[model samples]
Target: MELRHIRYFLAVAREGNFTRAAARIGIGQPPLSQQIRDLENEIGTALFHRVPHGAELTEAGMAFLEVVAQFPDLAERAIRAAQRAGRGEVGSIRVGFTASAAFSPSVPRVFRDFRRSYPGVEMTLEEANSAQLVAGLRDERLDAVFLRQDTIAGDGIRLHVISSEPMVLVLPSGHPAAQREKVALSELRDEALILTPRAVGPTHYDKVVTACRDAGFEPQMGQIAPQLGSVINFVAAELGFSLVPKPMTQLQAKGVAYREIEGEVPIAQLSLAYRSNDISIALRNFVSRTLVAHRQPRIDE
Candidate 1:
């Protein structure tokens, strides 16, 4: 019969008396008795034995009561699932990030906060070069990506600058430039530079190259690393010099010296891009939380 009938039956079965059961259900005893009869008639069996003192369950009623007892918890769980899905708290979001973005305080902090706030949301992280991160976003394999790219080339993409910081140099600790707290970009003109390929992070690459050009020298490129973190390893190995986001200095790239560039501060950026038309609630929640958590004034509103 109806859920109310099952509930009414269960209450009567528990209380063992129609008057008390009706009192618990806030219904008149006569109506409750009639409804119980109606349920029995519908189910084709009696569910209670009418006794002088109170009602005892029939064999069928005992079986039915056992099943009805489980409904409350089941119904509660179903309702909770609906509420969680409505609130975008139950689902999976695949996120991509550049190695450099992983080191940025904002990125990791946002992830930690998101996990803590929405424990029901399944978070999968893909760490790759910026180019690969963008590709994952384009292929729809990822819901969002954090990267540094000179140009985002797809109409289907919506990109936002999540974090920004100045680029700092990573040199061998024994290098002559390590003697200075700050070194001019021009002073490193003759140094062999270790940099991630332009394809790996064109925006960051372009910024570094443009800063060098502004200082009046074409960079003497040396080793090419596939990932940003690897650039530091190259520096540690004394392969060449590298310029990375200031946040990257947090990494323990032993034997490497971190320094600020003199005169002007060149900017390094971490951006997030997702499908422009994606209407998933989970993705929207993540983006909004990130912007708010990092105190980055919401740009897209």
Candidate 2:
């Protein structure tokens, strides 16, 4: 009736003697014989034919033995399944990232390497602004996020720096500065600046502002874009020059040109954020693996 009954029945069938079966199972012979009789009564059929020194199987006994023989293997597989799940080996994780962050090495590189180790985990990536990504993590709608930010808000979210790269200038292709391989931060002092608003990513926006200040002049503020990719589009439209992560250069815009800065380059932190209270085994496994893989190193300007 129970798994133990099935196991005991199989053992007795295999050993052919009550004493031998009980010894194999670490039980007493008398209890084993009584248990077998109890099992037969429950099934409403005799399972064994008692002989001179041992037991033989009845027609019903042979059929039942075959069925019970599979129970051990099945039980083992069930246990193994639970163990694997407990270890967070198989499940789904919903991840969030900024449009530009996807093109960066942090997301694609870390995930590409993570999948190799945890192929059973299904990863779903969504593109959102820093604000939206933060909201998703707070609401528990997203399992994790990769974004560039100066300071992250909310006590419910945890942030980690995955990669660091110096900020560069994205200028209109027709701009005179575009012809220069390197431009000075102070050179942009007189030019209008385009940037993602503080609401979208206060920390990242501040990083640029702080760098410009340290260079001896506050950048002249111009248009405000809601996201980094739009910051690039604004530059391509000749709206204004903008500071961006070096990795942002990978985003192809023929109308735009990327130039390194001559002064102290502000380092952009490519960061990962997730709900502090997230208890998903899949999400936890992903965070654990990624942290082990990505140790931030400051990139040169």
Which one wins on TM-score? 1
**Candidate 2 local Cα displacement, residue 227, angstroms:** 2.4
Candidate 2: give its CA RMSD in angstroms.
4.3
Give one digit per residue, the lDDT tens place, for model 2 in 1-301. 7887887888888989888999999999898888888899999999999998989999999998776778899999999988888988888888898876887766787788778877888888899888888888888788899888745765777787877878888889998878989998887788888988788787788888998899899889999988888999988889899988888899879799999999688888888888877788878778877776675332211
Runs with alpha carbons beyond 4 Å of true place in candidate 2: 14-31, 38-45, 53-69, 216-218, 296-301
Query: TM-score of each candidate?
Result: 0.88, 0.85
| lDDT of model 2, residue 121 | 80
- Local distance difference test, candidate 1: 0.87
Report per-prediction Cα RMSD to one decimal.
2.5, 4.3
User: Please, what are the lDDT tens digits per residue for candidate 1 over residues 234-265?
Assistant: 99999888788998899986798999989887
- TM-score, predicted candidate 2 vs. hidden true structure: 0.85
Indicate which candidate wins on lDDT: 1
- Cα displacement (angstroms), candidate 2, residue 179, comes to 2.4
